[model samples]
Target: MKKYLQIVDRHKASLGTRFVNNFIDTIILLIINFILSFISAVIYNVTFIHFFYFYNNGGFLWNVFMGSVFGFVYFFFWENFTDGRTPGKYITGTKVISTDGKKPTTRQIVSRSLYRLIPFEAFTFFGTDGWHDSMTDTRVINYKNYESERQLKDEINSIGVKETA
Candidate 1:
């Protein structure tokens, strides 16, 4: 733990989970989107012709626009509200903070999301940890301030309220 902190202190960066809980969050979002699509189809009275031709042209464009807007807005709002988490980050118990030890700005969120559009992600083999960290000029941190997070969880699960011995 001390080693991790020390390394961070020296390098201005720290180790954080890279798997990105956004996949799960994205699944949830996809469901929401699916529902929305159904509603749109019903409300717009989009026929098979529209569905095949003009349907996606306008619908797809609107969906992408809305999704981008919502993503940035959600990120900025939640990162400020919970001290740096999207729904995904909250679920995963992680937060993003400025790498320079400052709070993230709205601009950072926009830039971070946009930067993610680049193909630099493919440049890395396994995870986009480095790319993301660099893009936002931010680093993800374990939500718990104490290093005993894991130990505490283990203790709670390992013992019962009653004493056996």
Candidate 2:
């Protein structure tokens, strides 16, 4: 609706905010990976030393693949279950929604998550929105005062209706 567009246009998130969110999220992911990898190494050392060596030797590409898998799961579940607000988004005071200014469906969240797999998707923030957002037809907006804005919009609408009456 026009009101939704007005709100969205007025509260579009900046690229810097998006970048900071991603930076924080990546740090979280890296911390998680480090802990898991450490645990795995210890387990392998105790059970099968040779297998541990093989796993560690799998090298950079293997690490990247594993990281990508983790990233996909992390983003998908967080966005889907949290109504498009991840830990990073929470910190940044932003939330994702459909381009039409409604909550995104499960399918849309999944599509957005999958798009994160694309190389350099983070850099796409230089444009209006990120690649994940663009591909899924979603947007992230400044949500620090979303409730207040919604209430104000509702009050304004009510006033308009009363005037018409």
Candidate 3:
């Protein structure tokens, strides 16, 4: 596990991968919001006429605020259930892990999600460590590489020690 953590820390996702992750996640979140709005409209029997109006006439600040709240919910639930891989991260073959090389706790997920609300948080990805990652002591790693390496290591260690699973 320690060695796997080392691999994850060293194999942090690149800026391009991170960008793709962000783009994919944003689109997913938007879709989720739309679905929820549709459901609410159906419940009201409004047929979403007001929904379109809200999107078209909503204030910029109101949109931003709701987006942030939505983002928090989106990130928290996905990371928690998927063990740190959001839909975007899963598609990119990446995952969020603690800096110490363990699964993140609920607190860490909450902190990371909230930190994402920071203004221009995406810009922080330009640096080696993203703001949400650095603040929460987490990293987004290339899980494909990490998982393969971990499996290889386990195989080697089991040689002559135990029966292969």
Best by TM-score: 2
Q: Per-residue alpha-carbon lDDT of model 1 for 1-165, expressed as tens digits?
A: 111233223332133234455565567667766776666677566455564333335676676676766655555566666666777777766667666545667777667666544454524425435575665566666656522554575688888767678
Clashing residue pairs found in predicted model 2? none
- The candidate that wins on lDDT is 3
Expressed as tens digits, the lDDT of each residue in 76-102 for candidate 2 is 999899988999999989998876778
Given candidate 2, what's the lDDT at residue 127? 73
Where does candidate 1 clash, by residue pair?
Answer: none
Model 2 root mean square deviation, Cα atoms: 3.6
Of candidate 2, the 10-residue stretch with the lowest lDDT total is 1-10
Off by over 4 Å in 1: 1-16, 46-77, 119-128, 146-165
lDDT (0-100) at residue 163 of candidate 2?
Answer: 64
Candidate 3: which pairs clash? none
What 10-residue stretch in candidate 1 is worst by lDDT?
1-10
Model 1 quality (TM-score): 0.59
Better of 1 and 2 by TM-score: 2
For every model in order, what is the number of clashing pairs?
Answer: 0, 0, 0
Residue 11, model 1: lDDT of 33
